[model samples]
Target: MSNPKTKFSVLMSIYYKETPEFFNKAMQSIWDNQTLKPDEIILVKDGPLTAKLDEVISIWQEKIPNILKVIALKSNLGLGDALNIGLKECSFNLVARMDTDDISMPDRFKKQIEIFKEKDIDICSSWAREFDGDETNIVSYKKVPKFHKNIIKFSKSRNPLNHPATMYKKEVVKNAGGYKKMLWFEDYYLWARMIINGAKFYNIQEPLVDMRAGFSQLKRRKGLKYALYELRFQKELLEIGFINIFEFIRNVTIRFIVRILPKNMVKCIYKLLRK
Candidate 1:
């Protein structure tokens, strides 16, 4: 393995609702266990956090006070804005995104960085294994396309890349116009924009993170409001020239049908849809 001297930053955003215990677990996975340690971690506090959350941050700060850079916002700015703010403050050219509640594998960063060197990659992500209370008992695995061409083509029907498991160049994302405050589809919006702008996408075939999925994941996908969010995202994509009118109508219709279906049915469909 060839190790380069280049350093990268971990850009993450956290809000008040997340628990302290989960935060600690995620930190350990992202920081403690990485074969290639992050030089800097830029954490954005979306808003005022609870005392428990503060306590968790304190513990991590105590461990690596100098490396942890906290960007505190006065009020909740949502994930997209919080991340966009954090992105600018990152000290490195390359930044890896970490969700506050997920556990990345020990060799995740190492493998991703190695690919960045051996390939002309602008963005890199990996498959993720979904788990309930534990990582050992995986519920499912999510896979995305591995090459830029396939990724662009796949964007027509679903998200081309996994957001939480993704790492990309700071300049590339910035040039692509960064993230938008689009309801629940912020990451998808950014990916669509980036793909249209000719960004190189690569997905490591390995499962890089143990994603948290259970009742909460299912619950979030139900309801009419969520369906409206899907429609809203498709409309924006149409406006941005990412999709033609024919593709837009077809996608929205399909998504709306899935949205109204029974949760269990939708779950089965999701599994079948993702490769």
Candidate 2:
């Protein structure tokens, strides 16, 4: 209720395989913990979830009544499509992204809204503290540059913002072509398009969200399939002129090598890369 004048919508997509306990905690962080509550929370059920997940949604629905909106999909659509669909249903111009298994700091929205009010930026995300079993036990910090120009330079090599900790202008996202189906690089791909379209970007230096990260998450980053996805995404960026041939070549070569490496090596590399 701190920034009641600046209303925004929370957009999240959850599917099966996510535990109910994590989902409940995510829901709490967005509402119960936040200083500036969202006008509406758009929960896109990517597909049929477990009875337990459904039960948790039911409990929240009754608890919040009109504030929580559920858009259940008939079948499983991946994160990009699910978010694109949910984006259109959002009631506000500003939309904050959340994951089903992450934790947002209590002042996350308040801080981001202040940036939007003061700057001419379209999208912004803060640094995220990656944790494992408990929120207090921080494993690493996924940090990004603070200014738009630095962010633009950084995007050529890596994602310049944390997706789940982001709050973006809905129209800016739509104008940049929204989210696309880019497998493991969905968010990064959309960001490349937005950068090409000259959308302003910023990142807060402090960690505004606590992201859940572990060995399983690191393992998912490897394998032949993920390497292929990275290759395709880099090719798309090159084709769109977002990155030059040399940049594309460098990206593909490094990312491909990392993806095909052993999971333990990948973990160490990621740890070193992150703060």
* Candidate of highest lDDT: 2
lDDT scores in order: 0.89, 0.93
lDDT accuracy of residue 90 in candidate 1: 94
Best by TM-score: 2
Q: Model 2: per-residue lDDT, tens digit, 1-275?
A: 45448889999999999999999999999999999899999999999999999999999999998899999999999999999999999999999999999999999999999999999999999999998888788989999999999999999999999999999999989998999998878899889899988899999999999999855578777888888988998899999999999999999999999988887788889889985
The stretch of ten residues in a row with the least summed lDDT in candidate 2 is 214-223
**Residue 181 C-alpha lDDT in model 2:** 92
**Candidate 2 off by > 4 Å:** 1-4
What's the lDDT for residue 264 in model 1?
81
How do the predictions measure up, each by TM-score? Answer: 0.96, 0.97
lDDT of 1 by residue, 82-184 (tens): 9999999999999999999999999988899889989998999999888877767676788888888888888988887778899999999999999889987
Clashes of each: 0, 0
